[model samples]
Target chain A: MDTWFYIADLAGVAVFAIAGTLLAFRKQMDGFGVIVLASVTAVGGGTTRDLILDVPVFWLHDATYFAVIAAAAGVTILWLRLKAYIPLNRLLLADALGIAFFTVLGTEKALNTGVSPVVAIILGTMTAVFGGMLRDVLARDIPMVLKSELYATTCIAGAIIYVALSSWSQTVAMLAAMTVTLVMRFGAIRYGWSLTVFKEHK
Target chain B: MDTWFYIADLAGVAVFAIAGTLLAFRKQMDGFGVIVLASVTAVGGGTTRDLILDVPVFWLHDATYFAVIAAAAGVTILWLRLKAYIPLNRLLLADALGIAFFTVLGTEKALNTGVSPVVAIILGTMTAVFGGMLRDVLARDIPMVLKSELYATTCIAGAIIYVALSSWSQTVAMLAAMTVTLVMRFGAIRYGWSLTVFKEHK
Candidate 1:
């Protein structure tokens, strides 16, 4: 189970790096900018989580995450140089899978830190969504979480489910939470679902 | 000296909160959004620094910074409701003053953590510029540090000065560093100075 989780975490980092690189390509960012954005997208959320929990940053201690992010981003740039076409739809599906995995992973990590359940849930959601938010912001776009769609909502739901089921079985809880997240995100994308934004009147 | 530093830190928080609220007003963010941005702008950099330094977050330990930020943002909102005109120029000056102070403070804090000089300089610059970066990101604008002028550069220069002079006298070191930062920032604003952005060509 530990090995599986480790693999999933690395896979999630690669997917996120790829997603961030694609976005940077759209912005026509320089190579350095693309790499920076990709690295932030891959690790920003987890770093923030570790910081808030007052722990040493995972990447700094392990270094594997850095290696994966750089490799993923480099491959992405090279692939894009060879082929101009971007399969954004497939990337979105991969992103959904990544976020689901991250949601459960983040919740479990926060729970281990002895924070309250609600704080853990929020931290879990942050772990899943904050990286993408940082990516969008650096690209000078409004964060998808703050603007439209159920991006954060999906993470929040999955985190809540994980917390509720944790006393039963950790593996079952993780599986169920990820399934719920993936289902909701896929449904939103397939059905063109969106949350209504607040209207401000002067 | 500790009392004076605490007061200065609190004042910096208020100034940063006001600066953030003013920027949020330009984006026409709601009250809640205004407060959120203001708070992030006030503490984002320091929080990042503390997290990296593996220290308890200053605000989490003290809470005074939070109170100052809330009060500052609330006052700015009220002032704007009564007066439609924004003193953006003056606000820039105040921001310069705030960043200068924060640069020295952050450098000192990082040094106290026993990090190397280079890391201290980076952390200090992050402490001064990161909050504004977060504010710009949340507002869906390009971060000023990344986009235009010598924002981060000023902070960096100030941090370097602070680190260099630390072996001399802390009080003199702070004043000299702050003066350098203020001069650079004020010059950049007054003379319309900017760094040449790297152009990417396909």
Candidate 2:
């Protein structure tokens, strides 16, 4: 089970890297900026979570994540050379999958640290959303999670589910949370569901 | 002496919070957004450093930082209501002072953690600049450090000075580094010093 979880985590990292690379390319960023964006998108959230939990950063402790992100970036570059096109919908789907996996993983890690469930849920959402947030910020765009359809809300819901169910069965909790996240995220994208924007009286 | 350092640290937090509040207000952010921006700009960099160093976050361990930030924000709001204008030069001066103080403090903390000099300098720069970078992102503007004159460069210079001189005399090192940062930063602002922006062939 640990092996499977680790593999899925790496897969999630790769998807995030690809998504970030595509966004950077769209922004006309040079090579250095492209790699930085890809790396931050893949690992930024996990780094934030580990930092807050006062743990050794996962990438600094294990080189495999960096290696995987590099591989993903390479593949993305080659694919772009051939096609010169990446559909926005496909990128969103990839991002959704990564967010679902990361949300559950982050919540489980927070729970293991003995934090309150509310804190765990918050950290989980942070883990899933932070990298993308950084990516958007660096790209000089309003973060999609803040502007788009139900992005962070889906992560929060998935994290809440994992925190609520983990005591009963870890496997069940993980699976249920990931499934629900994917469904809600996909539904939001398909239906264009979004929370109301906050506007103040001038 | 420790009490002096503590007081300076709180002053730095207050300056950062005031700077963030001013920026958010320029964006017409609501009261809640203003507070959020102020808090993040005051504590975000230190939080990032603590997380990276695997140490307890200072603000979480001691409430004084939060209290100072809140007081600063409150004062800025009241002052704004009365004056209806804040000069840009005053804001830049406050930010420069905060950056100089934070760079030395962060470098000292990293050295105490027994890290290498390079890591200490990097962490110091991060501690000084990360909050402003975040404030810019939240406001949907390019970060000043990335685009403006000598912002992060001054922090790096200060951190380097602190790391190089601290083994001889801590007080001398702190004073020397802070003075150098202030001189360089003010010079850059007065003379319009800037690094060349990276551009790639299309």
Candidate 3:
């Protein structure tokens, strides 16, 4: 179980790092900036979660995460010159999968730490969204999560479902939660679904 | 001594909350958004500090901080309606003082936790500036701290001074550090002191 979690966590990191690196390229940030953004997007959410839980930060205890982020950034720089061949939706699809994995993993970690189910769900959503938000903020763009989107909502739904299905087998519960999150994200993208914004006062 | 630290911390919170509330008003955010920005600016730095140090979050143990932020936000909202009468520099002045207090206080706290002086100084700077960074990010603006400015440098300078002066009386060391930070911030505003940015590649 631990080994599976570790693999999923690293996969999520790589996806986030690629997304962040791509954003840096779009923003025309320098090489140093690209590496910084990639590292932050790959690990920022988990760092926040561990800090809130008053535990040693996961990445600080291990060097593998840094190496993975560096490799992802290197690949992204190479890919930037050949951008015409890549479809934009490929990054979005990878991001959706990354969010799903992070949401389930965060919820499970919070539950194991004995927080209330409500707080656990919220933490899971935060863990899934904060990295992307930080990446956008550093790129000087409005965070996609806070704008008109179903992004965070999907994470919230998955986290709640995970908590509710805790009585079932751990493996089954995790898979179900990830599937729900991924479906919601893909559905939103495919159908252009978005949350309604409050009308501004005249 | 503890009482003095507590008082300084609350003062910092109130000042940051007011600054955040005013920014929200400028951004034309709704009431709920104003409250969130105020709360984050008031406590975000401290929360980051505690998380890094593996300590229980300060606000989680005390309700007073939240009440203070609420009060500060209410005052700012009322002040917004009477905006023309208020001097434009009031918020900047308050923020300067808040940064100074938070820098010294955070440095002291880090030192108490047995971290090396260099790490303690870095933590202090993080405690002083992260709140404002979070506020700007939430408002969808580039953080002023990361831009051409003397903002974080002032905090870093004060933190270093505080650590160096630790052998002196605690009260003396804290006061000296705060005074230095406040002077640097005021001088920067008065003289338009800013860090030079490296020119972007053409």
* Two-chain DockQ for model 3: 0.13
Which candidate's lDDT is highest?
A: 2
Worst 10 residues of 1 chain B by lDDT: B193-202
Say which docking band candidate 3 falls in. Answer: incorrect
Q: Which digits, one per residue and each the tens of the lDDT, describe model 1 over residues B1-202?
A: 7787788889888999999999989888885988899999999988888878788889887877888998999888899999966977867876888899899889999888777787677678878987887888778777666544678778888999999998899888989999999998888889976543223334
Candidate 3 accuracy as lDDT:
0.82
Model 2: per-residue Cα lDDT at residue B93: 88
Docking class of 2: incorrect
lDDT of 1 by residue, A1-202 (tens): 7787788889989999988888877666642456557777888888889888877766644557767887998887777777755776866886787789889988988999999999999999998888988888788778877774888999999999999998799999999999999989988889977677667678
The TM-scores of all predictions, comma-separated, are 0.61, 0.62, 0.63
Give residue B86's error in model 2 in angstroms.
Answer: 13
What are the runs in model 3 whose C-alpha is more than 4 Å off? A29-33, A70-80, A83-88, A187-192, B1-39, B52-54, B59-129, B137-202
DockQ of each: 0.14, 0.13, 0.13
Q: Compose the digit string of candidate 3's lDDT tens values, residues B1-202.
A: 9999999999999999988877765665653456657877888999999888977877654668877998988877776665523354876787898899999989999999999999999999999999998988878877868873789999999999999987788888888899999888998888888777777678
Candidate 2 chain B: minimum summed lDDT over ten consecutive residues — where?
A: B27-36
